[model samples]
Target: MSKIYVLDTNVLLQDPYSIFSFEDNEVVIPAVVLEEVDSKKRYMDEIGRNARHVSRLIDGLRASGKLHEKIPLDNGGTIRIELNHRSFHELQDIFVEKTNDNRILAVAKNLHLEEETKEKGKRVILVSKDALVRVKADAIGLEAEDFLNDRVVEMDSLYTGFLEVYIPLDMLSRFYEKGELFLSDISKLPFYPNQFLIMKDVMGSSASAIGIVDKTKVKVKKMTFNQEHVWGIHPRNVQQTMAIELLLRKDIPLVTLIGKAGTGKTLLALAAGLMQTEDFHEYKKLLVARPIVPVGKDLGFLPGEKQEKLRPWMQPIFDNLEYLFNTKKPGELDAILAGMGSIEVEALTYIRGRSLPKQFIIIDEAQNLTKHEVKTIITRVGEDSKIVLMGDPEQIDHPYLDAYNNGLTYVVEKFKNEVVSGHVKLMKGERSGLARLAADLL
Candidate 1:
């Protein structure tokens, strides 16, 4: 049975090509959705880019046939610009407002009623990204769903970049003796490139070792910083140890760290960047940046010059740096950075359109970025540069991005098999006991 899906403006803005995702179904675009999209097309962000793309896509489709009627899609589905649904009396009695969401709901409700009266009644579904809109549709006896075409994977089943293997004591001994073990020696366990492994004894012994899968072999290795710490911070957990290894390794140019609050993802990245750029002189400079995503409220209307206005947004980065540099008072870290002349902190917005070379770049709070934003950041890395992306996927503030579809997880999944890339999911929080408890229970 063919279903008729009424798309909301957010669905179109989230994915410009979502009209073709429904195979053999009918896609209806309410005129209100187009109006809402038009209102957003003038902005200069990712949302605006998508809005413009959706408009151009619809315009290109007009060449084939009229959108107000029905235009056939290549995937055996049909799309139509639904302009006839101007008002619905049934919705006014329930919603009591003529908002865009209510208007969209009215169109879906009307279509659902009309389909129910047909000899072969077709299903009418409202597709939207907003939870309230979907809930309202359900209240009005209409089926509704979220736009899932862009979702990469579920949260529970997400890749964690590490696995545990219990093997015979002799195998562990051989691994420790030979310094490495091939996958064939370990029962052909599935392993991704640069994935960390905790090899334990299966014979009820207390023997355990940490290893990392680089090529086809797993090499037994310890943490990078033992005698000397990265700045003043030390690895308090195995996950942090693994993160430091990935961060300091010159072979892995791209590294990603996923964790919850207080998991030390950004701290470890910053520490490694400082070590590589300042102490080791492996890179020319240490560049730290993060996306300017608003959490509860936006900061556009603040009063200041650009740098002064960005102070609050970048305060978290400064806090981490202050802790690392042991800056006791305000402006202390600034003087130190000015004296070093090897550190630059900027926003991701202004970093675009520049080729950065010989720099250790760290992009914190990476979960708020989309796949395109991640691509833009990675493409800007010039020769002899390393980029570390750290974020808590569960703490996403972006309206359109989620744990599975955000740029952090996208890059983690995409680069799992590459040699030059490494990923680590920090399972333990080392910030403080209270913070760790809040991260888990709260």
Candidate 2:
């Protein structure tokens, strides 16, 4: 039986190509959704770009026939714009306001009623990203579901970039003596490239060894720089050690770090970038950036120059830089940045359309970015450049993103098997005990 899917405004804004994801079902677009999308097309952010893209897609669909009538889609599905059923006679008493959500609900409810009378075994479902809208849909006796097309993996089963395997005590000793172990010598479980491994004794002994899968995916090799400190910051745990190994490698150009608050994701990336750019002179410049998503109520706007205006959003980056540089005075850090002429800290908004070569780039708080936005940032990387994306997926600030669908997680899952990309999910919070407690409890 073919079902009817009514898309909400947020679903289209989240992914413009979502109209074609319903397979062979009928896709219904309430007229009010177009109005909502139109209002967002004027902004210069990702939302505006997506809204405009949606408009272009719907406009192009008119070649078949009128959008109000049923238009055949390429995926054996049909799409139509719901013009009538805006009357809130069914929900006026339950929902007094004539808001856009209420109107969308009215259309969905009326469609359900019409389909039920026909007895065609057709189901009418409301698809939305907003939680409250789903709740309201339930109140009005309409089936609702979240848009799950973009989710890379479930939150509980997300890849942690580390694995534990039990081996014989003799094999562990052999790995320690040779400084490497082949995957054929271990269990038959699959291992991704650059994935960290903790080999333990199967007989419950105290001996253990840690190694990383080589690019060939056949051998588990010891970390190259596990003992060395980068920018005066040492790895506090096994996960951090794995992260540093990936960050310091020149062959792996793309690295992703995911963790909770104070897990040293940003700090490790900054340290490795500095070590590679300043200490080794391997890169021409060290560029750090992050998305500008406010946590709580936005502070409206500030009055200042471009850098000064970005101070509030970029302060977290500066804090890590200060600790690495150990600047005691107020203006010392600014003077150091000015004198170096090789370090750059800016917002992610200005990174588009620029070709960056021979540079060490760090994208902090990358979980706030959409998949499209992250792709834009990564595609700008020129030759001989490394880009590190680090963030806490559990603490997303973007209204349209979550732990499973955010860009950080997306990159982690997509690039896990590649030789030039590595990922590590830091498990321990090394900032302080208080911060760790807060991250766990709150």
**Local distance difference test, each candidate:** 0.88, 0.93
Best by lDDT: 2
Q: List the residue pairs that clash in candidate 2.
A: none
> Candidate 1's residue-wise lDDT over 1-442, tens digit each?
8999999999988889898899999999999999999999999999999999999999999988999999999999999999886667888778987999999999999889889899998999999999999999889899999999898886588788898888899988887787677766765767888888898999879998888886654543443444456777788888988888888889889999999999998888888899888889999999989898888977566787987777888889889889999889879988898899998888999988999999999999999999889999999999999999989989999999888889998898888888899888999888899999999998
Error of 1 at 247 (Å): 0.4
Residue runs of model 1 more than 4 Å from their true location after superposition: 217-228
Which 10-residue span in candidate 2 carries the lowest summed lDDT? 221-230
